[model samples]
Target: MKRFLTTGCAAATAIAMTASASVAARTLDPTKAEDALEISKRVQCGVADGVPAVYHWSGKVYSRVEGEPDRHLFNGEGMNIRQCVKITDPKRGTGYRQVSREVMFYLDPETNEVLRTWENPWTGETVKVMHIANDPVNSRPNYPYSEDGKPHQISTLRRQGKWLFMPFEVPLFYHNVLAGDYQDYVGNKYHAMEIFDFAMLADEMLDTKNPTAYPTVSWVRISDWMPWMKMRGRQGQMVFNAMGAKLKSYDELPKVIKDEIALNHPEYNKPPPGDDPRPNETTWTVFKKMVDKEREAAKNNK
Candidate 1:
């Protein structure tokens, strides 16, 4: 069996910086529709320019059945680390860019142990499992000004001096047919729908000098059963509610989680390099591809 796991806000305070000084501050304006883009960006990253930050998240999954109430499924923990670097000098560049990487793993609900291996009840086959998924390096534009961009500007205009938190919803749907040989285990085609609801907030005032002070985010996901569980066309969905906060260092993670990362994927022990250029990919998409590849290999071997 093949398995894979995949998976901001603003505030105000002392007027140390203004819109002209910070690109994030200048881009915000609740009254203007165009500022929505800036708000989205700032909520995900931060208002500051050229500073790195890390985030830690822990949550649980629930299995929802139509007639019966939802039951606990499993626990999950992950980390996302981003490096925002500023490009100075017209010859080299004159803007800010960010490189980010994330990883997530599923664990036993009761034991809180990472689920590394499992035995298939149907085939009695022992399976090596990897419930974790690592995101590809993602690069995006960053905020440069302190008060000019959306982060700072929105704090005063949008939230009206209160804490700023934004809600967003994302829907995903995709289907693909298995290529060859391994079609017997997994049906010919795979289909699923996932809806994500997110709330983003900032713990402190948006400031350019403090790029490490980024937004904290929480989300809930409603989706089809994970493919690796091999529900065999079962009818049900999974619900996940998780909250994440920026961390000062990797050592801040739980000892168990840190040990797992060191043992299985040591490369992720630290955040990705600032220069990494790989683009992010969806977990579902990657999982389907891996399943198909394994099935094809099995077919060819026979």
Candidate 2:
């Protein structure tokens, strides 16, 4: 829900590739930041200028606690449609502005249907379920160099035979919008770890002549319970494990996902504009908006 930043499905996953030095030297040198950007764009968006690319993933969500066996809580399915635009700075040289939107649904584990209501095993009470529909999961202008004037470089790129593994681990520890504001001292800041390991053909990604590269993605997320789950601050975390690959068309998605998006989300049919100016959204911020809207409607009725 944060960036290409997030996805999951256990049945959809394949074993991830590991890095190896035995693989021959590649077409584009991974050591170069500009070449790294090309490899990244191929897997994330597309290198061929402005075009929309999509990736879909699904998997199981489980409850993780200190002294107990993890419980299978729910299943999740999600996708992101994104694009990149060329950005140039006299000082920073040329880079890409990446922008996109995404949605993930929580589903019943047994029936594989979207959950409108959930009965917490820990609590006897039933509560409404809230799915993640974060918008504008955009990124800052990414250049080949940083403000400090160093090459915008990266590490941990490994090649195994023909497959190249690009892994991005995003650690989220910002303020939680739903919690109170003394957070800097109170220590209730939002915290989570999202792992996105993309495995693609080394040749395809390094090909400067191509527009994009299709990769198999493995995603794992560990974080707190969603607000709508009504855990009431139960001390536990949720683990989302999933895997999938890039697709050539939206119609390639599962029937359930296609049907749901068609009915509830029209804008999601495509990514946000390349120059979308809105800030990025997370699950907590979206949850706050939902509660605020409900409160306003209830007050008007009163």
Q: For candidate 2, give the lDDT of residue 224.
A: 91
Off by over 4 Å in 1: 1-51, 85-96, 118-128, 137-162, 175-203, 207-209, 273-279, 292-302
Tens-digit lDDT track of model 2 for 131-216: 88889899888888787788866586898999888898999998899999899987878999999998989777775545678999
How do the residues 1-302 of candidate 1 rate in per-residue lDDT, one tens digit apiece? 12222110122222324543554543244444334434444544533543456777889988887788787867989877676655543332244566776677888789998887655444475665656565655766533333334232333323434366555565654344323456556544334443323333333433323433445667677877665666665667888878877666677887777887788777776556667766665565667779879999999999
Best by lDDT: 2
Pairs in clash, predicted candidate 2: 8-58, 8-59, 8-242, 9-58, 9-59, 9-242
* TM-score, cand. 1 vs. native: 0.65
Measured against the true structure, the TM-scores of the candidates, in listed sequence, are 0.65, 0.88
Cα RMSDs of all predictions? 12.6, 11.9
